[model samples]
Target: MNVYMKEQEIKTKLSAWVAGQSSGYHADSVPFDLRIIEQRIITSVQIMELILFLEHLRGEPINPMQIKPGAFSTINSIYQHFFIEGQAYA
Candidate 1:
């Protein structure tokens, strides 16, 4: 695997995570229009779970600053934070 995941890969993994976290969603697929804020998937209980998921995916400690208001707004947003701007492990 590449040290850093491409945009689409990150999005796919994030979608999978979202699906796993939600009861009615499918783990293998996500809708193109899905948005975290609109879907309200990020409940207070999910914050730590999300952090741990990102850390595991990136193989590094995720910074607290990256967990901002719009960080988990969408799969694309999470990709940008973890892989693009934040720079996943190595």
Candidate 2:
């Protein structure tokens, strides 16, 4: 596959893994509007955790400074961090 396609695949896989991890903590009674708030918090935490996990998988140390603001604004952004930007886990 092309580099971009491969990156997209990685992003999708990472997003799914992150979502699955966060899903376990989700509340069933959260209203739809409040769901956005919950998701934002969870997404932020998940992104950080996912980065750590990726770093671990790649046998590297976590670099908190490298995680830019808005880096995890969207799932696509997280993918870009790893594949397009070559940030990997560390």
Best by lDDT: 1
- Which run of 10 residues does model 2 get worst, by summed lDDT? 28-37
Q: How close is candidate 2 to the true structure, as a TM-score?
A: 0.57
lDDT agreement of model 2 with the native? 0.55
Model 1 earns a TM-score of: 0.75
Best by the TM-score measure? 1
**lDDT per residue, candidate 2, 1-90, as tens digits?**
987777655655555555566554333322222333235645556656777766754456757677666555555665556545744436
Tens-place lDDT digits, model 1, residues 18-54: 8888888886677635786677776757867888888
Q: What lDDT score belongs to each candidate, Candidate 1 first?
A: 0.72, 0.55
Off by over 4 Å in 1: 1-5, 88-90
